[model samples]
Target: MELWPASLAEITPDLYATEEVESEDKEVVAKFFALGSSLTWYVVEAQKLEFGDVLFFGYVHTGDWNSEWGYFTLKELEQQRYLGGIPRIERDLHFEKKRFGELDLEQ
Candidate 1:
């Protein structure tokens, strides 16, 4: 995913503790977004993984707990900390006939 060019180098850090101390965590998490009109796009998911934790986040964001916006994952999160920050971007990955994993991380 494309993080806002202005975002910090380690835009996202220590999303949370791992299975060593896990729970069905859910909260209003801020991720570096490259699209739309904000430095970060507030999305929801089962988890917002950072570092080498390769896994897909879940859907369902909510103030009162009810606003499913689909899931996002972290592949290059660890490989390139400089480009991560945004989890589960929705830049036409579904409508553009493209897969989320199709995004280039070689930059």
Candidate 2:
């Protein structure tokens, strides 16, 4: 699907942008083995990130949906993927609320 970020962010001016997240904004990606719904994560070296650190260049979900793009360690992600077995990424990131909605928009 095609997304028009410019229209939404520019019209609102205060919502579209990249911000450095804190510890709570980080996401965890992992590979898991599932047997009929029973899942087990792969914590081996292959699950590690490729770079020392990773930051997602994505937007967060809000307004009834509590979700964020989340940060990760790239080197670790790539390393883990190279392990050879079936591996995937899993992360538990958080969502935030907007506090500037109260501002009056200039028509």
Candidate 3:
């Protein structure tokens, strides 16, 4: 198994290349334990930008977390209705449409 960065945003290309090699050789590595599945992964970490806080990227299996699987902002997470408001579960209806082409509800 080999790990390599798939892309570079701009600021550091050489750093990404070097990191890719380290990641592959296991010198530098990352692991994610969330949503139940243990995943070996990497993250760019949070960066402060001119507009606001920015987080690069990371990935884990869908089964790791029971998320509806879509893009979301931290603000949205804070505003989610589950602990109070409209309920995040309802939001999955949209994902059902996007992923399965329809909301079966039965699943």
* Count of backbone clashes, every candidate in sequence: 2, 20, 1
List the lowest-lDDT window of 10 residues for candidate 3: 90-99
Question: In terms of lDDT, which candidate is strongest?
Answer: 1
lDDT of 1 by residue, 1-107 (tens): 44322232133223332223222333323343334332222322233335534333423333233534444544433233334544434332222212223423222
Which candidate would rank higher by TM-score, 1 or 2?
A: 1
Looking at model 1, residue 37 earns an lDDT score of 31
lDDT of 3 at 107: 28
TM-score of 1: 0.25
Of 1 and 3, the candidate ranking higher by lDDT: 1
Candidate 3 C-alpha lDDT tens digits along 1-107: 11122222233222234334322232212222222233222323223334442333332224435433222222333333433454331211111102122222232
Stretches off by above 4 angstroms in model 1 are 1-26, 35-41, 46-51, 56-68, 76-107
- Winning model by TM-score: 3
Question: Least accurate stretch of 10 residues (summed lDDT) in model 2?
Answer: 40-49
Query: Positional deviation of 93 in candidate 1, in angstroms?
Result: 24
Q: What TM-scores do the predictions have? A: 0.25, 0.21, 0.27
Residue 82 in candidate 3 has what lDDT?
39
lDDT of 2 by residue, 1-107 (tens): 11112222233222123234342432212222222332222111111124434323332333234433433233433344324653343332221223323211121
Q: Candidate 2: lDDT of 63?
A: 24
